[model samples]
Target: MNTLLTSLPKSTPLPRYATRLLGAALSATAYAVCLPWDLRNRAETAGAINETSPVTALGVTFLSLSLLSLAAYFGIRDRLSWTLLVVAAPPATLLYASLSSHPTQDANAWPVAWAFFTLVLGAGVLVAGSVARQFGPRAR
Candidate 1:
């Protein structure tokens, strides 16, 4: 049993808070970049600036893939609390976008669908992380 264990590859453990920071940073960066495009697309569609395009769907897919991957990586190597930290990025960024976009307007200009999608995506991230943790290697 000892020899078998010795022959297996070892992975470096992530430091505490590493997952939290990395996950949040990745999520925030993704949202910062994608949200602007999403907003522009929505505004144009509403104003009839041009016909709608596939960019919106592509952006959403990209965000989903990237965020889910980040969550899974954290879940496989770190605790669940750290993985959950990723969920905070969406609302924080959304608030920033809202205030910056329309400080005087009483109504929010961003689409409500995205706010709802945040909840759904967050839950998906949690589930992905939880599932990954189940398959991760256990410490001795």
Candidate 2:
């Protein structure tokens, strides 16, 4: 019995760092998938394109943010600091990608504005994650 116990393999959990990375990746992908809708809305607002369905755009935004929140929830787990990284990834990616396309000072402000908006959304993501940590399925 002692020899059998000694031969049993230990189960290894995923490293927190890896989970954080996975969360960031999922968050960024969610943003990337939804960016086109945002860009189209911007273009329509600028009169560079025809109008689009406000409902569709709103739905996309909600879906993307939901994805981000879930990513933060699962990725951050018990680590508060991980929330910062996971929350920032999507907006950082968007801001960086938009910088090269800023054709004028006025146009440049849009990205900054969007970044601020996303930052607010990111705060919500953090709250959602914290709430889930306290009450969701895996909650202790």
Candidate 3:
């Protein structure tokens, strides 16, 4: 099991373009899912009906699944996947917004979340550059 776990990253190597496109798609999906939730939350906070619709629940479920998938995909590698990192950004942004808007019992936790988000975004940029370098023309 340990050997299989160690070899997982080597088993799934995606191309640069594919990675970028997938990342963009995933990010867009995350944004789409979160937007409605955000709007609903705002409406509720303004004393509107606080109802849990099935669609909202499903959207949240999808968001959770995407986050989990991203973590698992990126966790296996020494070098993170830029696509997965991009996928992580929206949810992280939502987390930041949540933390900022309502200070919970543990307001101090936001900094750690912020740091993690920064790290993921930074790693995405670095890995993207590395992937881009591989696209250069080869010598004869």
Candidate 4:
């Protein structure tokens, strides 16, 4: 008697689309939500975004590249660099978020809610990235 299940692969990958799109989207959204809010206050947003002032700006660029790499990763498996970029994005974005937000409003306010969403999305991407094995292309 065969006990094998055909639907499941030996690979323990996160859903490829979720990891690729969600990770990049979360990183972008987090930066979108937090960066402007901080800047609007006329504060030096960099101070709150972690690391040296110049480095935080660099991190923003890095996350943006990471997101683009996630798209690129979907198209080409030959380049190992895309994997690193996608993998690195969540933590870097989260680091910026954690440092940037000051919670000027009530805890339940829209800004706060949006910020929280960004955090959850960023963290979820990290969790998903750990397990993502890029499955869909094979299914096709």
Instruction: Highest TM-score: give the candidate number.
Output: 1
Worst 10 residues of 3 by lDDT: 131-140
TM-score quality measure for candidate 4:
0.27
lDDT of 3 at 97: 68
Q: Report lDDT (CA) for all predictions.
A: 0.60, 0.55, 0.50, 0.44
Error of 3 at 13 (Å): 12
- Would you give me the overall lDDT of model 3? 0.50
RMSD of each: 6.6, 7.6, 10.8, 11.8
Tell me model 4's lDDT, rounded to 2 decimals.
0.44
Between 1 and 2, whose lDDT is larger? 1
Off by over 4 Å in 3: 1-14, 34-55, 76-78, 81-84, 94-140
Q: Write the number of the candidate with greater lDDT, choosing between 2 and 4.
A: 2
In candidate 3, the residue pairs with backbone N, CA or C atoms under 3 Å apart (3 or more residues apart, or in different chains) clash, namely none
What are the TM-scores, per candidate, against the unseen true structure?
0.61, 0.60, 0.38, 0.27
RMSD of 2: 7.6
**Number of the top candidate by lDDT?**
1
Stronger candidate by lDDT (1 vs 3): 1
Greater-TM-score candidate between 1 and 4: 1
Candidate 3 per-residue lDDT, tens place, 6-111, comes to: 3333445554445445655676567466445332333335655343333466776676555555544434422444434555666566556654664244235667
